[model samples]
Target: MAQQATPVRTARLGRTLGQEPTAVSGAVLLLPGGQEVSGRRPSSLLANASVRALGRRLARAGRGEGLAAHVVHYRYRGWNGGDAHLARDATWAVEEVLRRYGDVPVCLAGLDMGGRAALRAGGHEAVNSVVAIAPWLPEDDVAASPEPVKQLAGRQVLIVHGTNDARTDPELSFRFAERAKKANREVCRFEVHADGHGLRQYRDEVTALAADFMMGTLFGRAFARPVRDALAAPPPLGLRMPLAAGFGASLSW
Candidate 1:
C-alpha cells in the first residue's frame, strides 16, 4: 500500500444536545411538515415538494443572517405519525448540530405537523429554540395543548398562521394560546389575514421572527423580572411573548 492519509477532525462550535458536533451559532434544524399522506413513506407528514423548496429558501435566509440552518426531512415508521418520533429525530439532529458548532445556540422550526413536532422537541433539554406555524393538535379539534405538554417548555416560540386557514381553523390558535397561558410559558402569536395553510400573506414575518426568536432565546430573558405566576392560573401574554427563554407563539389568520 502507498502512504496512508489520516482523516481531519474538527471541533464543535454550536450547542450540544446529543453526541454530534454542530457549527458555531450557525446551524438550525428545519423539520418540514409531513402529515399522514400518500407517499413512499405514508406515516410521514407530506408537506409536498413545494414546501421542501421553501425549507431551502429558509435555509438560505438563515445563512444570510450568519446562521447555518439546514433542513432535515424524514418519514416516521407508522400510521398517523406522532410527536414521539419527531422528538427523537429532532434531539438527534440537535446533537449533530452541537457537535459541529460547539457553543452556539441551536433552533428548530416547522409548519403544520412539523410545528407540533418542534414544540415537542423544544420541550426537551437539547433544544434551545423553536418555531411553530399552524401546528396540528394532538387530539381532534382540541383548543389547548394538554397540561403535560404545556409544562415541558423552553426557548422562544413564534406561532404564525392565517386567520382563515381552513385546514386547522383559527380557533385552534386561540386554544393554543390558552394552553401556553396555563403553562406559564412565554410566547408570541400573530394572526395574519388571508394567509391560509400555505402562508401566502406575510413572508417577511418568517425571517424576522426566526432571527428575533433565536436572539432572545440565546441572550434575552435572563435579566428580566422572573416569572412567578402559578401554573394553575391563566398566563399573561407578555410572559408568553414572541421573545424569551423557552418562549412560544400563537399566530392566526
Candidate 2:
C-alpha cells in the first residue's frame, strides 16, 4: 500500500509543533510558497513574525471572538507540486488544526505556493473560509484550469494577487475566482498594491484586508451576498484593494 503523507518533525527540531500548545486566537496554516520552504523546513518558522502579525492584527476585530489561530508549519515528504499528491496531506493538516482548536471555526490564508495548498486543503467541508495570496490554481500555466476549486464555491474564499506578478499572470487569480463564483461558491478578490509576487510593497495592507475578511467570515458577517458582492466588485484603478477600511477592526499587521 502507498504511504500517506504526513507532517513530521522539521529537519532540525529546534522549533516544533505539539511540543507545547501555543495559545492562539485562531489558526493560520502557512503552506510555503513552493518546494523551497517544504524542502528545508526552515528553523525560521512564521510562528512568530508572520503568523503573530496576522493574529495580532485580527485581535482588534474583537476580543475572545472565540477564535484560535495557529500557524501550521509542517514538513511534508516529496515534491510533485500537484494536488493529487498533496491533497490528502492538506486535508489532514486542516483537520489537525481544527482538532487543535477543539473544533472552532477555521480560516486559512496562504501566500504563493502556500496559497495553492491552503485552497486545496480547505476546499473540503470542514474549513469555513480561505484567503489565497498570489495564488497558483492552474496546473498547466499555459492551458485552461480544471474546476477543482468548484468544490469550494459554497465556502468563503479570498484571492489576492499583484497585478504585475509574472510568476503567474494576475488574471489567473480572477479566472479562478470567476470559476468558483460561477459554481455559486462565495469568494472575494483583492489586488495587492505594487508589483511582484513578494508583496513587499503591500504586505501590511494585504494582511490587514486578509484579517478583516477572515474575522468577518469567522463571525458570520462576511457570508452575506451584499458583503460578498461588495468584496468581489472590481476596485477602480488605483484603489488599495478590498478597501481594507470598512471592517470594524484596526489594521495592525
Candidate 3:
C-alpha cells in the first residue's frame, strides 16, 4: 500500500471583502464556494467536507514536492453576480502568494462559485494554472462579463465536471473548456460520468485526479500513466466509477 503524506498547517490571514487587501503568504491557496449574504464572512473550508477533503489531498500531494497550502475565507461569501466579489478575493489571494513568495508559481482550485472565481482570476501573471471543479459557469447571459477566463490563452487549465451535475450545467463547463482549449495548449478536461454538482459519489477519485493534475502543472512532475489512462477511460454502464485509493484499478484515460 502507498503511504499518504502528513496534513499541512492551514493559516487564516484575515478577512477579505470588496477592494480590501490582505498580506501575502502561503504556496497554494484554496477557496470554498458559497453565496453572498449580508454582513458576514463566507463559510470556512472546514464547513464543506468535500472541498476540505480535496484540499487535504492536494496538501498531501504538494507536501511531497515541498509546497504549502492556504484556504481563503471570503468576506462577502456570495457570487453577487456582476459585483465580482468572489473573483476580487481570488485575485487578491494570488497577488498575496506572489508578493510573499516572489515569482513563485501558484495553482488556484475551486468548486462551484469558487470554481468560477478561480477561472476569472486565472489570467493573472503569477498564476501558472487553474483547476475548476464543477464550476458554476452559466451560459445564459453573464458568460462574457467575467473576462479573465478569456485571458487563459496560453495558460494551463483543467476543467473537471460531472455529466449529472444538477446545480451547474456540465454543458456550460464543456463549452467554456472548448473555448479555453482553443487558446490554451495545456488545457485538459476530465468529465465525471454520472456524479452530481457536489461530486459526493466520487470524492476520492476527484481528489486524486486534482492532486495529479496540480502536481504536474505546478511542479513539472509527470502524471502516472495508469491514473491518466483511468481518467481518460469512458464510463462503464453509464454510471460514474470511482478509482481505487492507491494502486488498484487501471485508469482508462
Candidate 4:
C-alpha cells in the first residue's frame, strides 16, 4: 500500500512594532493584500513591505498613547474563494493580540484583499474598529454572495477608496458601506479623488485619517471634524465624502 500524504502546517505570524506589547493600551493589526487564488505559498515579503511601513508609522504616531502595532504575515498568498483563508488569518491575529495584550482594544486595518479580510473579521470580540483601504469586492453575479454586514453592527467601520481605482471598483466599496451603514450607523467611507488602488497620491492624508480614526476608536480621542461629520451625516454625503488636501496637516495629532 502506498503511504498516505501528511498535511503540511503553515504558521500565521505577526510582527509587532512600537511600544512593548505588554505595556500598550491599544493595538492595531495590519493586513496586506494578495491575489484572488494561489496555493499555500508563504506571503511575499516585498508585497507586505508597504503595510509594514504603515505599521511603523502608525506605531510612531500612537506611541505617546501606549499603542502597539502589528503586521500579520499570512500563511497563504491568496483569497482562494470560499476558503476565505485571509479572513481566518486576520481573526487569528485578533485572537493573538488578545492573548498577548490581555483585554486591550484592537483595530483591524488592511489594504485591498486584506481590507476585505479586516471587515470580515471585525466581529471578533477584541476588535473594536476596522479600516479598509481600497478593499476588493466582488461584482454582482448570479453566484456572487453579498459580504456580511451583521458582524459590523457594533464596530466603528471606515472604508477608504480611490475614485480612480481601476484595480478595485470604488462603487462596490460604496455599496458595501451602504449596506454596512444600515446595519451599523457608525460605518462611513471616504473617497480619495484622482487616486489609484495604491492611494500613493494622498498617502499622508490617508495615514493621518487612519491614525485619527484608530486613536478616536481605541483611546477615546475626539475624531477630527470631517471624520465626525462624515460619521454623523447620512447616505451619499457620508459614504462619498472626499478626502481633502492638507487634511493630514490639519489634524492636531
Best by lDDT: 4
**Model 2: per-residue Cα lDDT over 1-253, one tens digit each:** 9989875553211222222334544544544454422444333444235544554555444344544444544454323545333345456666775565566666776666557767777766667888888876664454645637666766777777888788856776777676666664356677654557766666666666776677677765443333456555654321224434334334332
lDDT (tens digit, per residue) of candidate 4 on 1-253: 9999988655455656765544779999999998899876654678788787778878877888888798888878889999888899999888887888789999999999999999999999889999999999887666777888899989999999999999999999999999999999999899999999999999999988998899899999999999999999999899999999888796666
Residue 21's lDDT in candidate 4: 46
- How many pairs of residues collide in each model? 41, 11, 11, 0
- Per-residue lDDT of model 3, residues 91-159, tens digit only: 888877666667778888888878888888888888887888988886745545433457786567777
| lDDT for each residue of candidate 1 in 151-194, tens digit (9 for 90 to 100) | 23655555666777788655665566666644545555655666
**Every model's TM-score:** 0.64, 0.70, 0.76, 0.94
Better of 1 and 2 by TM-score: 2
Angstrom error at residue 224, model 4: 0.4
Off by over 4 Å in 3: 1-26, 36-39, 45-47, 141-148, 226-253
2 or 3, greater by lDDT = 3
lDDT of 2: 0.58
Model 1 residue-pair collision total: 41
What is the TM-score of candidate 1?
Answer: 0.64
Could you give the candidate ranking by TM-score, starting with the highest?
4, 3, 2, 1
